[model samples]
Target: MEGSKKGYQFTAGQERFRNLIPRYYANSHVAIGVFDISNKASFTSLEFWIQELKRYAPSDCKIILIGNKADLKEKRQVLPKDKLPWTSESKHPKIIEISAKTLKKPNSILDSIASEGLAVKKARTLKQEEEERENERIQMYGEHSETPPMRRRKFLMCGSDRGQRK
Candidate 1:
């Protein structure tokens, strides 16, 4: 069989994954970077996917990191909640542990992402509004850790909802 002939020689761009990201995930809000916890060979592939997204996607794209195939505890090359820090440390991708065999904590990882998606959408709206005001350049990251020299965006609709909810 022609399929069996190629099955003998496996590669990264196999038919299963080829065009899968664009065809299926084009309109998807969340991009999940998943790797086998049992395979050391997959340690770097996840990093490659993240870089691909950053290079091709927007500045505030939503991504959740998944360390999959964790049911085989003894075979786990990387343990649960392993921090894969390949980029800016001040901002980090959340590392999630999930086992398809056990179905453990998969929803927690996805639920957190849903919440973040809402924030990302809200941020996009805020960015659009800020864009209208030709003078405002909204800083994207690390706005929480530092106190501003003065509270200027106090009337900003994006942040005003935040303070009202608190």
Candidate 2:
């Protein structure tokens, strides 16, 4: 059997990868910018990545800056805990350092990601349930139903929970 001809378009960019950002930006909820601690050039490109994410990703998108190769401190060019000066906004991106080779404990970087993911999941679930309940109430009584009391929503963060008006 003769195979049918198929074609695909793939985009390639330099290390900064500015071209790929627009393709995935609209649907992405999280943007992870990974850089090597042993390479100064990779670390320097992080600001450009952040700028692209801010320009294309949704306003509520969460950004994470990671400094990899933590185990290779002997060859390190960038400090693991260097503070980023540009992310001083209200919703600052999370900064984390990790080494794939030297993770020993259960409380590793993956654990942190899981916990944060759980919080975001819980918040979305709660919002969905609230919307369903509201819809049910609207269906039962006509459009003139009394407005329900507004409840304070609890937003979960890395290690704390904060309240926000809903």
**lDDT of every model, 2 decimals:** 0.62, 0.64
Which structure among the candidates has the greatest lDDT? 2
Q: Ten-residue segment with the worst summed lDDT in candidate 1?
A: 1-10
Worst 10 residues of 2 by lDDT: 1-10
lDDT of 1 by residue, 1-166 (tens): 1121111111253557644544443433456666788886675567766776665556676777677887878988886545565877655677777888889886777567776666776788798787764333225323353434344455355435554643
The digit string of per-residue lDDT tens for model 2 on 4-104 reads 22222222326555556687776454566778889988877777768877898766556766777778989999875565656676666786777868764
The residue ranges of model 2 lying beyond 4 angstroms of the native Cα positions read: 1-29, 55-60, 101-107, 136-144, 147-166
lDDT of 1: 0.62
Given candidate 1, what's the lDDT at residue 87?
A: 71
Q: Residue 25 in model 2: shift from native, Å?
A: 4.8
TM-score of every prediction relative to native: 0.60, 0.57
RMSD of 2: 15.3
